[model samples]
Target: MPSILLCPQDTAVFTREYLNGWYSLSAYYASKLTSDLPMLLICPTLFTTIIYIMTSQPDVFARFAMCWGVSLILAIVGHFMGLAFGSTFDLQMAILLVPGLSIPFMIFSGFFIRIHELSAIFRPLCDISFYRYTMEALMQAIYGYDRPDLECHVEFCYFKSPSKLLKELDMLGDLYGHDSGITN
Candidate 1:
């Protein structure tokens, strides 16, 4: 966030976009605070681990499968990114920035509504969200997936897939019964 905003004008490149443009970008960086990634991962990992460990009649592997599964991983990774260098944690800025930043993303991540169906403030979040991108990635991986959904999904966006995921899922359905749910 600040990287885009706080670039020293003399040190940074400009394409005659104009002085006002540079000023606005710099102001935005000055007003931003970064979200700490390692801290965020630490908190959730502890919660999931505790929940997985504490529940009696526990199946450790099953708990991981259920709780820390692909969807959660996708969401967590998205969080690390969206908040990475997001804004300064100042209360004054945070007061507006926190809700301004997150509530919309929460609403847009398809947990609340489909992309085509959003309204008001939420509509913008959908347009800009990395979560939306990541969600598409997850949907692609599991859907019509090959034997490699695990590797590709955990590695997340690193690999490029030229094949359509739905096509893979469709082909998989032919080779294996769709009802088994074992392809993933």
Candidate 2:
């Protein structure tokens, strides 16, 4: 939302400045990215830290780092996507289009529908959804890589075993590296 609102305003000023030969295009772009870097890093780190503790996620530093990294990447991608839309269209149109496009991505993200259960044609959408990859990586970080079985208090626990749960989710393989594009 910040990118969507700010990028257009920045572009207008940038265009005028560039036309007046105030700075090279590359310099302005580089400066803009550099300025935004701190906020990008800080916001995700804060958010990940709070949520990681609040949700009672595993205390392992590596797992927390994985969640934070995935969150940071997602934020960067979302920022760029908003910037693209803001630069390409009017504010109202960009606002409408962003959510409109996101609905399909969310639907295919494997939270509501498993990829294996999806239709063959729609299965490809899951492959492209960043949410799907993020979810997979987070799951793997918290539950995969030979994690022991969860402690179940009830007598009839269906998914006490992390491996069994992953298998049921059709995410039994070690694809953390592939999913997040970072070697695990």
Candidate 3:
């Protein structure tokens, strides 16, 4: 009635069926928008203004939705998160985020340079470095350096290369048992 160009009689049937199929597909996708995806991402993309107002208010609804809502959908229907995301966290290192000596341990743990490289006066400081623990853990994770091989290299490398100090410590570790400590 508004602007009919009067297609051929057979074409009208095909056109009507095409229109119905298109409408059905749009409705199917529209229904999935709520149950299928992250509401924050999907809601705004599907309806921009509605997303803006709901997000602007900053309510508990947003918080709960973040932790629970989408994950629930994933659990029930999609990826079966029960099997997918179990405990991959390292509780030990997480605990060591703080250590006993605290201050100097962080300073000495060989992050910037190895601790064996530090000055002789600061050598005693190595006894308390958490950096040493972190380096030892890293090295042990790769391959454990035996106790003195671990110790003197850590000391000399604070200023010099730990590899060279490692050689010296190899000699020392062979000569001395676990108690030699770091001498000048």
Candidate 4:
């Protein structure tokens, strides 16, 4: 909606007539950012509320904080995507490419496949992937700090600190400390 309404026409008109120069890209970007803010904030906030309630996730505040962060990142990426591909056909191509891009990130997320099992070259991809950070932060938010005790069968009893599990998966829970209180 934003791109369809603002791009290639309004952007040209505003840049040519209003700003006195092409420097209005910032203004254009800001306009899109502001216009989308309400849906961007409301959808994630409401979705987080529903999912957290259903899952009974502890540290609701922290989880909501992380969810909001992820949503904002997504919105920023989406906004840039519109700017990157100004034409409708190009935008459609970018949308088609999203799933292709997501597959590697999903593989490296440590949920679909263990991070340790990934080749050394692929490890860096996991580090860069927002999905990996999102998953790690959510996991740390759920299980960090409190050190919950669980009754486990003999084999599973070896499972200990959530931090240790994070280490085993090569995700640094400490990294998201400020973002979602994943650590102190």
The prediction achieving the highest lDDT against the true structure is 2
lDDT of 1 by residue, 1-184 (tens): 3322232332234324435475565554343323444544566667667765675323435425434444455445544343442333433453456456666666677645776566675677776664554445434433323333323435455333424544432222332222223344
Top-scoring candidate (TM-score):
2
lDDT tens digits, residues 1-184, model 3?
Answer: 1011111332355458657775464554354345444643454344433543464423334333332332333233212221112112133432233233345666765655555678878867765653454344333322223322223334334514334444443322222112122222
Q: Which ten residues in a row have the lowest lDDT in candidate 3?
A: 80-89
Arranged by lDDT with the best first, the candidates are 2, 4, 1, 3
lDDT of 2 by residue, 53-162 (tens): 99877788988988898889888988888889998998899899998998888899988999988999999899889888888887887889888788889999999999
Please state the error at residue 62 of candidate 3 in Å.
Answer: 44
- TM-score of candidate 1 to 2 decimals: 0.34
Candidate 2 TM-score, C-alpha based:
0.94
**Which of 1 and 2 is the better model by TM-score?**
2
Pairwise TM-score winner, candidates 1 and 3: 1
Candidate 4: which stretches are off by over 4 Å? 1-23, 59-63, 78-89, 150-173, 178-184
Give candidate 3 misplaced runs (Cα > 4 Å): 1-103, 144-184
| Better candidate by lDDT, 1 or 2 | 2
Given candidate 3, what's the lDDT at residue 65?
A: 36
lDDT, model 2: 0.88
Clash statistics: count for each candidate: 6, 0, 17, 0
Ranking by TM-score: 2, 4, 1, 3
